[model samples]
Target: MALKFHIVNRIREQVKAQGDKTALRFQTAKGWGDISWRQFGQRIDDISRAMLVSGLAVQDKIAIFANNCPEWTITDMAALQIRCVPVPIYPTNTPDQTAYILKDAGARVLFVGDQTHADIAMSIAEQCPALEHIISFNENVDFAGHPMGMSWEAFMALGNDNVEQELQTRIADAAMDDLTTLIYTSGTTGEPKGVMLDYANFAAQLESHDKVLSISENEVSLAFLPLSHVFERCWTLFVLHNGATNCYLSNTNAVREALQEVQPTVMCAVPRFYEKIYSAVHEKVATANPVKKGMFHAAVTIGNKMATSIQQGKKPSALLQASYRMADKLVLSKLRQLLGGQIKMMPCGGAKLEPTIGRFFHAIGINVKLGYGMTETTATVSCWDSATFDADSIGLAMPGAQVKIGKNNEILVRGPMVMRGYFNKPKETAETFTEDGYLKTGDAGHIDAAGNLFITDRIKELMKTSGGKYIAPQVIEGKLGKDHFIEQIAVVADARHFVSALVVPCFETLEGWAKELNIKYHDRMDLIKHSDVVEMFEKRITELQKELAKFEQVKKFTLLPSEFSMTNGELTPTLKLRRKVILERYKKQIEAMYKKHM
Candidate 1:
């Protein structure tokens, strides 16, 4: 009920209910530490006062250019409480991208993660004319006498002389129509566009999310995904609304270590996280002794049957149920340990998750709820219910949201969670919706009789071959990228005679395989082109292609020495492939494949 108001209301409610309860936990060099709910609310109040002291006015834009840490959420809540619009920029963006967002949002104050972020902000200060103040979250950072920059310690001290009455008045004046945040899209194809969200959008999300997911006050959540993105940001708000403890991972590289330490009951992640976990599990099992490997496979087989039965709301056969218990003891339990042995529900979105991987995890009792949405929809459009889960689809539409398959099968959505419009892009915003009120999702999908939403591909990403057959590259890539040796893949089929691919192999595994076979190689480039290595991949691709139509199967593939990355303009901030960038970068390799066939 508290969620009906601004998200700050929920934080205050939690403080009143559990003043001394641990609300946030983060890993330190020595171990883990926590901050209580009362302390969290006090920080928000202090920060909100500081923001006002630093010249932040109601409806003013403030940017938080930081990673997933406690400060990011604190600053976001501070903005919400004071009715200021918080604009978040990805921590990985370059100076140019950073400046563009600041200038576009007309951000008056920028909160940086560290000295590096402050340096970037300083570098673009001239370009971002409206940016007035720079505050560093890390107190220990050396400012070197930057004119506009101040340490967080100095910034927070500015509020010490202030009373709480001013911040309280601002919170009391909070309205649903006030602009809450300006979330910029990752701009996989072009410059990022700011999506405007309001209090009503968030309230709708909380209502819809409540109908599908039930989180207890005792549950804990692991927060690793970038807080700038809507998927993580909105989910974090939900966690705070439910009064659950959230553990933050300072370094994403330490995800495996943190997972074991946190052992959270609920988590939100993208498909990539699950894919990596699946790959790691298989890579380890592949090296196990034959008896151990057999046991692992047997466990999966039994677990899959049990999972399937449970998903369909039927009891597993007595024999299968008995086998699952044994499997859980021998193999599944060990697998669960990698995720901290206590994950009850994990909601995955951002990209397509292969159903096979979904089955693999669910077979072992991990409920991986695959869902679908975009930044424009305030994150949640459709997600699975635990009792009526479907691996192949994103499940039924969330409550208060209406979904329909429109012209060309593009997923159309109409709901309160939909954004008001793109900031300062009237033409673009007008184009994004249909004559009817529904927002055009740009994703091609179909809903089955059971109301399960199965995504086919991005409408703009669909490619037509020279022979005039259309193909969904994502589906093909999803199928092939799940291979143990394939780390990443982008299928090339646009105007080409046959489908091809650019692959980045899992170099560590590939090297191990090479050493076992006595295949000598100097580097990745050499290993990728070796005849034996090519043949091994060819055999694997041939087997995988059996599931696809002839035109949809990749006819030729060239392995690259490097992986696609956000820094390299090949991937977006959310790790989604930038198809146009990838195609342009590998044009020569793609052209050669067609030339040889001709």
Candidate 2:
């Protein structure tokens, strides 16, 4: 169905119907605070009026350089209400990257979260000639030396009776084709391009999600991921559209504590979140006594059986049902409590989630909805249905989204959710699509008999060894990365004769193991170089890769003291590996691994 109403009108309808009910929840100096629908509407209107007063015309680009916060969404909705395009800059982006986006998008106003963001904008404000106003979300942000800087409070107060008519006219003129947002892709290869998404794209998402997800006004979503990314940003809009409350989590490190405090019914997360949890749980389980360990394994086995039966549309036998109840009480229930015991659904994406991790979550009664998409697709091209369970596939294609294999097994998509094109890059945009108009996803995948999409690997990222063996690095990385001892792994096989990796150990678990083994070291580097530590990793890697082909196994590895990070240019904002950067950064270590063999 086509979008019948503009997003602003939908939000306005919710405000009138659900006034006094909480619409946004955010952290405060004391504790969690709530914003009623009435307040939310008022803030959005006020911000809209402020934009008009500040001389922002229709189609003007406004940038939000902030972490996940209530103000971030408020600003985004405000921009939509006034027909301005909201361009999000990842909070973790370097100054040069931020400046590039601001300049590329021609953003006139930049909204910053805190002093750090304000400083970044201030430093690059001159570099972006189009950037005029700097609005600070934090009241304490000192706009000391900047001429066009002001706190959010001051910015809101700029609106008055004068601009009310202009705001109303802008709202009344909102259209489905109106540009909603320009989300710059965190490119692993080259310069970032703005993906131009319109209101139609999001409206299709809202319509599609209605058919697949079971969510309502009663649901509470923990906004754990960065609001800058399309996955979290799109989910937040859907949550607010359903009159559900969204709890913003600015600091990602505090997610565990926030999950417990919020007790959210629904949340969106990446695969790494589950991977870490899976690894930690197993690490603990490995240290348990033999009796406890055996009992845990038995419970998981029963739970998996029950889950599989349900997925297959078969009623569990009475004996199986009874066994599942016992397992739930003995093991699964405790595991649920770790995630606050209220996660009805968790939409997992951004990368391939290992099948083992997917099955483990299902066994513990956590609904981890594995899905696929990209920034160009405005998030989900496909997602798991509540009753559908596929450990090896990324579920069925989303409603209204047509997915088919194109040349070289590339996944091609044609849907309302796909972006119009990359902003101001007509040549690149033309190259991104086929003659038949399908968006070239650049991902190699195939559809099974059940119509489920199974992703193989990124076509561009496939590595070819000197011996003429082609390898999918992600497949190898996903397998070995599940081991409790391995925190992160970057497979190194391109142009080399054998597979090798740079491994980062789970420091907390490794420390405990080292202590038990009476191993001593001075620092992280020293600890990673310890002979016992090397042997432990070698053994774990062997066990993890037992199912893999001989050519796919890691022949050798170098233990790293640190995990790849965004600040170091080793990872993108969405936690995708920047393989080129990683390869260049650790050139010496990668060379050492293949030195003897080559």
For every candidate structure, what is the RMSD over all alpha carbons to the true structure, in angstroms?
Answer: 1.3, 1.0
lDDT of 2 by residue, 300-408 (tens): 9998998899899999999999999999999999998888889999999999999999999999999999999998998999987667658989999999999999999
Q: What's the lDDT for residue 433 in model 1?
A: 93
In lDDT terms, how accurate is model 2?
Answer: 0.92
Each candidate structure's TM-score, on Cα atoms with residue i matched to residue i, is 0.98, 0.99
Q: Distance (Å) between predicted and true CA of 550, model 1?
A: 0.7
Evaluated at residue 224, the lDDT of candidate 1 is 86
Best by TM-score: 2
